[model samples]
Target: MWVSSSAFEALLDSGACACPVRLGQRLDPSGEYVRRYVPELARVPGDYIYEPWKAPIEVQERANCIIGRDYPAPVVNHLAAAQRNRNAMKELREMLQKAPPHCCPSSDDEIRQFMWLSEEGQATATVGSN
Candidate 1:
């Protein structure tokens, strides 16, 4: 669900699964106006949000779009977007690092035997494998 998880849950809560405005890949509120002009489709290497305003004029010119005069203002303020991404990534990293490592009670030999159809099959396969 990406960032739309909350909105999806809201729709389910309201029993409005078929809500018309609940469009997937929905157009920006500003509509095709954004697409017709330059869209910073993605963030550059280090930056999280595509904030055209902060980009150098030379960089914008190289990209073949003028800043302010050419591209529309970012839908949300860049500072806010940057903060949101930073916090989200931080939380996610913490969650992942806290996840438990998995281990089985069986040893490597036991695992190999368990995977085989029978002990005879395991012995035969294990002989060839080794």
Candidate 2:
């Protein structure tokens, strides 16, 4: 429960989840929380709030905020972070498989053959297929 809540909170804080303020896309297109924390983008229009980097010169002038000048660019690229995390997880999975069986807790009912990758690309396991 703690992990789930923390993950949910992370998504919310990162603006990766849909905003409850509006329907459709949950992405914080309006940059409500972002603008609140990042005051440099407070005057940015709704269209470019989430992505101030895309704002044009005129828009920047009108808003009186310059990207990289008034506010620093986004510290982390979500796409790159996601790819890195995926690679790390894959490595961990490989390491787990190579570790000695005695290192992990054992279970009865043929636990060794309980897991398999499904055709749809899901990492799945079956306790009892029936």
Candidate 3:
């Protein structure tokens, strides 16, 4: 399969990670990029936000025409970005762990079924869109 991540995975496995990164969109230098695209991620529920700088250097190198002096270097380290996500999830886990386990909020099986059907419907719609 054609996939880009395995290379990085190997690097990581070998411990050559001079700086690991998290992935996220941020307010581009002009702020227009963020203003236009940040809203798209709003649908992704959770306070944990991805920080763009966290993306690995290989990602940075690939920016080509995308990021330059015109663009701001990632404001924070990807390691930091990862930590932020971890902290948010950790907080969530702590909250859940401390609570009574009686919450049947939603059945995982049901959610999976609904997701499958929704994906199928979406695929059909996509096919029909042409």
Best by lDDT: 2
Candidate 2 off by > 4 Å: 1-29, 100-130
Answer with 1 or 2, whichever has the higher TM-score. Answer: 2
Q: Give the per-residue lDDT of model 3 (tens digit) for 1-130.
A: 1121122222332222233212222333333444356653232222222443444455544543123342455666656765665566556656866877643326444554655657445554332245
Clashes of each: 0, 1, 3
Query: For model 1, how does the per-residue alpha-carbon lDDT over 22-100 read when each residue is reduced to its tens digit?
Result: 2312534433433444254232211211345666777667665565666665566545655675566567556856877
Write candidate 2's Cα lDDT for 63-118 as tens digits: 88888888777777756765665566566556866876433214433343344344
- Native-structure RMSD, model 3: 15.5
lDDT of 2 at 116: 39
RMSD (Cα, Å) for all candidates, in order, is 15.7, 11.3, 15.5
Of the two candidates 1 and 3, the one with more favorable TM-score, higher being better, is 3
State every prediction's TM-score relative to the real structure. 0.27, 0.51, 0.28
Candidate numbers sorted by TM-score from highest down: 2, 3, 1
TM-score computed on alpha carbons, candidate 2 = 0.51
Clashing residue pairs, backbone N/CA/C < 3 A, model 3 = 21-54, 22-54, 54-78
Model 2 RMSD vs true structure: 11.3
Q: What are the Cα lDDT values of the candidates?
A: 0.46, 0.59, 0.41
